[model samples]
Target: MIYVILLTTIVLYAVIAIAIHFRKALHNSNSHQINIQIFRTLFLIVSVNIGGYYLNYFQVLIIIPKLGNDIMAIRKWNQIVGILLNVSAASNAPILYFTSTEYRNAFNKEWQTIIKLLSFCEIAAATSIEQI
Candidate 1:
């Protein structure tokens, strides 16, 4: 169940990244009729992510919440899994930025900062989860 949620969230994150890519592609060039096929593909991807996220969210929040406070073992396992999921999801941001030509061209050396931010977020999330 948790795996499903993480997988879906990862897919959604990819779609969102793709959307950003399309937006950048459009803005980068003056070319008209900027590829409907790409946009269509991105839109479909984004839609899938949206659906997956919601499905995952329902399973995590609603179903998990009902499990109550006594399920410490399950709760700990979920927390660890959630932390890993968030860390993995967040780690992709730097890759996304690097892959997007616009971002890479714009930031150049400073792109490392974006990566650093992702690393920081992952570390922070993991640390917090462990502390909990």
Candidate 2:
């Protein structure tokens, strides 16, 4: 049952990501469209990161307690980071959709910060999952 849910979520995300990528490819010559595409990609990345980690959490939570304290801490941390990435990704959508130049510049900076956070979340996911 859980495997079915995880598989569905992953496949759905892959399809969406591919569609977004193709949309970006179609708009390659337009800077505005390209920027929007970049944002879309980032948003999808956030979604995937969150979904993967949360699904992992659900999968392991029952079994992890038996593995002892360190593993549990790692799982909890990954879950929290996944949540943060999701919020950051959602927050970025408005910046892409509705900001003026000055606001866009500031939002761009915020976007950079979010990217860094997302990157860290990816690294954390990779490392922690390895330990698990």
Candidate 3:
């Protein structure tokens, strides 16, 4: 089931890429790129997951050996894939901060609000401590 899902997704993404690649309208020379490498990161996340699934599937169906080089290699591969998963999750903020002006503005605005709130809390704490 996991294999089917992952294979299907890979096919779907291939189709989408081919479609976009051969789009009817010739892409302008000066194309405005967006998303801050989001697609590449997403593709990495999806593709590496197949390794993790393969490890699980083998363990379930074939009874992966208790200890062997092949099993150890697969386990190591799955571990690496698991860490790759964090790349996509952890990269969004820095990517958006660099790529999107809107994200920067919004982030700065929210950050200011946090700073103000923290300062207010500090002042309140100081006053309360003095009273005590």
Best prediction by TM-score: 3
After the best TM-score superposition of candidate 2, give how far the Cα of residue 41 lies from its true spot, in angstroms: 3.7
Q: How does each model score on lDDT?
A: 0.60, 0.64, 0.62
lDDT of 2 at 99: 39
lDDT, candidate 2, 4-121, per-residue tens: 7656766876676666665634444676575565556555555655565565566467646564778767677667666765565365456444534555787789899999999999
Assess candidate 2 and give its TM-score to the true structure.
0.32
Q: How many backbone clashes does candidate 1 have?
A: 0
Clashes per candidate (backbone, < 3 Å): 0, 0, 0
Quote the positional error of residue 115 for candidate 2 in Å.
29
Q: Write the per-residue lDDT of candidate 3 for residues 76-98, one digit (tens) a residue.
A: 75666556555543665766676
Stretches of candidate 1 above 4 Å error?
Answer: 1-52, 55-58, 61-70, 84-92, 112-132
TM-score per prediction, in order, is 0.35, 0.32, 0.45
Runs in model 3 deviating more than 4 A are 1-84
Candidate 3 residue pairs in clash (backbone atoms < 3 Å): none
- Judge candidate 3 against the unseen true structure and give its global Cα lDDT, from 0 to 1: 0.62
Rank list by TM-score: 3, 1, 2
| Runs in model 2 lying further than 4 Å from the true structure | 23-28, 35-132
lDDT of 1 by residue, 1-132 (tens): 866865676687677656655564454465423444345444554454445455546657776777776588557757765665555445434544544566557677676888999999999999999999
